[model samples]
Target chain A: MDLEFSPEDIAFRDEVRKFLEESYPESLRGKASRDEYEREDFLLWQKTLYERGWGAPAWPKEYGGTGWTSIQRFIFQEECARAETIPIPPFGMNMLAPVLLAFGSEEQKQEYLPPIIKGETFWCQGYSEPGSGSDLASLKTTAVRDGDEYVINGQKTWTTLGHFADWIFVLCRTDPSAKKLQEGISFILVNMKTPGVEVKPIITLDGSHEVNETWFTDVRVPVANRVGEENKGWTYAKYLLLHERSGIAGVGRSKRAVERLKEIAATEVSHGEPIIHDPTFARKIAELEVDLTALEYTELRTLAAEAQGKGPGPESSLLKVKGTEIQQRLTELTLEAVGNYAAPYFRGFPKDGDNAYPIGPGYAHMAAPLYANMRKTSIYGGSNEIQRNIIAKAVLGL
Target chain B: MDFNFTSEQDQLRDMVARLMREQYDFDTRRKIASSEPGWRPEMWSQFAELGLLAAPFTEEEGGFGGPIETMIMMEEFGKGLVIEPFLQTAVIAFLQGIIGGEKIFGFAYAEPQGRYNLNDLATTAKKDGDGYVLNGHKAVAHGGPMATHFIVTARTGGDQRDDKGVGVFIVAKDAKGVTTRDYPTVDGQRASEVYFENVSVGADALIGSGDDLALVEKVVDEAIAALCAEAVGCMKVLNEATVDYSKQRKQFGVPIASFQVLQHRMVDMFMAAEQAVSMAYMVTLKLGEDDVERAKAASAAKVQTGKAGKLISQDAVQIHGGMGMTDELNVGHYFKRLTMIGQQFGDVDFHLKRYAKLSAG
Candidate 1:
């Protein structure tokens, strides 16, 4: 019945807050936006957490995880988002690890889990292809098994952080002759530096290289690299997608963005007053806050259900759909608040030895790009439309 | 009672559509938008040759058309998501540069302190001898970088927000004290933070005399209508593109368009685009009405178009899925342009309140 955290949880929140305050790397302090984050920046933050034994907060305690309670995990995530920490990319820790934990062999777990948690390697997802985004089971990436290894061949587009990733978890068609399209697919890992692997950056509309089209021209991988039984990777992938959508409802980050939006609006002038003073702009922010509150409660309810030993169900798709809409709306409002400054597109702001000052406010540098880039939220992670499809069929049984 | 375009307007649309197809395809437009000048002077020459430069002026002013011509032209421009400054230099303002394709022009009305109020100008032109000395920053002057000349707003008499003091001045971009920091906009167009430090202009440079806020507002209303027309172009293109894409793109062994859920969405997009087309035309028809009616129509059309643009663009992107996200596709370009148009002169909320006020009165 209570909405407030327990006393112990509150204390744990404070402890985590204090830990972030003291231990968050000094270099990563002001670089809240992802534009400034290099591979080293992410590694620094992840390693800092790894050093604190908090790298994989949601993993089981036996798998080098803190094994915090669901509420504690929620609190930790909230604090990290509020602090605007560079997110630990989900490829290794969130997506692949869960798949590995659920379906990997003992040798695979023993070999990979420690390096993943220790921040020794970066992993990128390889489920999507040019022809196979929403229709993921129709993927054409093939893994023809050699005597001792699998010869993988196909291109995986939108491989987030593929440019610098140490490894990629690819979904390959191990048995193309199978009766069902979903049945032939197998989740397999590939090294990015293998003989035929290629990484070509796909510049987004924002003119930034956050994702890439990763090519594998007959790359080799040991047969041991496959997760779970052959022809059953669809089950494991669906499981991972469920895990992906759970955190896609980014209420914590959206709340922080709201506060940031308010600050920008307060500073931006409209009719001799701050834009926030304008009833219309104020109302949009208020509506956004209300929407975020509803989403927060929905997330909290899911977390509570998890605490009660129930897994997040098809309803988590609601969070993905709504959360992405809210996030997109945040970008919209931010661009609105920034006003005419949104016109200026900075390809790379204040690059090395380029001391030319940007034309507008420092906050405005990334406003439009972030707005353009944030469109990926709904499109990625099974798209908001697919999520809606999930809600219609799975939730409503229509 | 007539919503149909005149024969001339239809010819204009057909001509522009042909030029856009032949010369302004998606890749060419993208290249020019990112090129050294960020726009095509040659395109301006073609527009000028096609009599587009003088289309908005009265017949007395030696032009064959009015806002309707702009509406027709901008709609086609929207379909291509044309990156050139036709909106900036023609409908939004104008370019005498069309002759030699040399003298680009921009409208500098917005100020740092003025959100959407066309009258809230802090830039001033205090009279000195045969000219006036101008000093103030014009925020994000549309087509500012390429513009060799600017139609700027400055206060001649009263305080910042007062409607009575505003004066319009056409100043040369290279005026002694003028400086510009040019940058490409998010929508792949170019703009500048144009600063005026005692920049001087002759008395002749002033367009029509004192208290020009009403003139500015009227021009803005026309511009908003023109923008609405352009947005409808974007929405219609996007809606159709989404339909085409969904029909081609398959998921679950059928075109995603086959899903009743998606079918409903495309229907919504189509309907929104249709309603927006009606509003754009309505506003154009009302552009010559009395002040209050014109203002109301403009605001109402802006609100309709802005809200419609949001839905159509987002849904278009959503339906196209990841392909919509890539800069390689035309969908994202159209989406970005539609997004920028939402906040161009006044956003949906601003126009909503404005429409409400005018309606009450």
Candidate 2:
């Protein structure tokens, strides 16, 4: 096995490097560098990629994808991440677009794919409910069939970016009497602007309104909005969860976090020396870097498998279980590196929207919120516990 | 970037794994650890026949394979909890072009007062005409009981704790003024407190010329990487053993693996093990790089493996209940080995500081 990029791949990398250097917006970079980006801050860079015909790297070519090889896609992501660019939200692009292309009807495809490609429509997942998260198949959300519409009634909690989303893909029970809990589910798409739909904010420990509780009462969803067959949505839902978990590995982002931590540690002082000079603190950074390198190699191997026509399968669970935890760890170390500056309003509340005024170094303010927000990574995308059981059954046959 | 091993490497690993499963079961290993000299000569010859002892040296050094090969062998050895000095003798010194024959080698560097500092040597080797007279004590010389020769680090010119003026000398175990007090370590391996009382050695005994301390440090870093690989292998076993135990041991009329809390803990252990494996691979990848990058990778791997080892070993025993604590169970032994691995080369705290110092530069 060879790790060195081919001459052609190296040329492509140069091209990507040039584009990032020349076209990446300074204002968006400013916001992203501080973890204070709004939806628009994220959309700006995504729209730039869309214009350059590189928005969705993994989507099929027919669906406005770049059709780059797996290594090239990896390079593109590595470049974007290393440049500290805001991640193009996964819901509409990486998550929903894949499901739609694979399962959505031609009309559904024609309507949704282009909007997602252009970053004109924002989407969020409505899979988790207050009473049902890891045991997702046991969701109580109901979609009763009407003349031409399904009356939806449910509350979806931990609906990340729900306030900003224009539409949400939901899993609802269409047949309660089915033999298995999973068999009775139907995958339906709902407009957030429907009369009975409400988005109520749930401020997390970091005091950010990043997630919301979405209430759906008598929401009218047309039968045409359903993905694949009714009462067989479990199949589609499982497919979507795989895509979601696969992308949650966050290897690129963690690399950026390491870079940021190094920068902060090099500047922040403890006992008359930069904290980075302190063996204890530096070792912590080094340890994180080591863990990140491993996750990254695993991610690359997963990509190679994908290149060979294999879906993520249980490995996605491994990635999700490890990736999100690594992300959480970087934030924890960042908070620790910033020292008492991470004190003010940390886990207290986000007084402002997403941006909080700093008490010390410019980097300190983002530490607390980033750490608190990252806590959701393990809990969502199926709690790490469920992923292990999946590994036990599928990988180990235990 | 490419994580796939060559067919030869794969074959080697599989063969070693087969040997471990067939001949080095826990009971057999326990018997060996309890025996005099604390290791088996037949097993050592078996390793030599398998080319495991020669895996880290180049052909010019009269051996086949490289660091990757040695890493593969050490990992398998770790899985079996093999109480041999293959790492102590082969990878540690053979890489330094020091090993000559079947004679076991011991490194005498750490002292009574020298916590983790390689330069804090009170062991002095002053010149007396063509030969040098050495006088000092070396604490915790790993593999000491089995060592037929010793690689002793002594200060020749610089002050105590200074990095400069350090040198390494090869001394025979049966030398006139040498003494060793040997014992089994916490992890069931043999170590010794070696005393050097005006031991004389010829000028030919000096291994390398400049900055011998630095050379020793780099060699120790390689040893640390090998240890990290070994820890990863042990963690893999612990994770699997813990999961199997959970499936068999019933609690509240059901298998404990079915408990959500325990399941989550097991997953955490799995993640730790997997991450350690990843870091170990990374260290192997960075093995022959320039000193700074190599040291960074070693320290990073050391930290991750050390932490992961602790987490996996502890959780494995905790989940196994009282049976995990008994001498009859392999889980507790694995924990003991992991604990020793953490403290070896350098513990998490020590390497963390070293990592920070390097990053600052």
Q: Judged by lDDT, which candidate is best?
A: 1
Q: Which sections of candidate 2 miss by over 4 Å?
A: A346-358, B1-260, B263-361
Q: TM-score: which candidate is best?
A: 1
**Poorly placed runs, candidate 1 (over 4 Å):** A350-356, B92-102
Candidate 2, residue A218: how far the Cα is off, in Å? 0.8
DockQ of 2: 0.02
**Residues A1-398, model 2: lDDT tens digits:** 98778999899999999999999987776656655557776667778888999978888888888889897988888888888888787888878887888888999999888888887788998987755655678788999999999999989987888988899999999999999888989989898998999998775533456778899999998999998899999998888888888878878878887998899888865433677888677888888889888988998999989989998789889899888778878876786566534433323224465454332456865665565456566667776767888899999999
Local distance difference test scores for all models: 0.86, 0.80
Q: What's the TM-score of each model vs. the native?
A: 0.96, 0.55
Q: Per-residue lDDT of B280-351 in model 1, one digit per residue for the tens?
A: 989998999999999999999999898899899888888888888888988889988998899899888888
lDDT string for model 1 (A1-398, tens) is 99888899999999999999999999998677545668888878888999999989988888889979998989998999899888888889999999899899988888888888888888999999988998899999999989879999999999989887999999999899999998988999888888999999888878888889999897988888899988788999999999999988988889999999999998998777898988778989999999999999999999999989998789889999999999999998998898877777877645574635657776787888888888889899998778888888998888
Which 10 successive residues of model 2 chain A have the least lDDT summed?
Answer: A340-349
Name the docking class for model 2: incorrect
lDDT of 1: 0.86
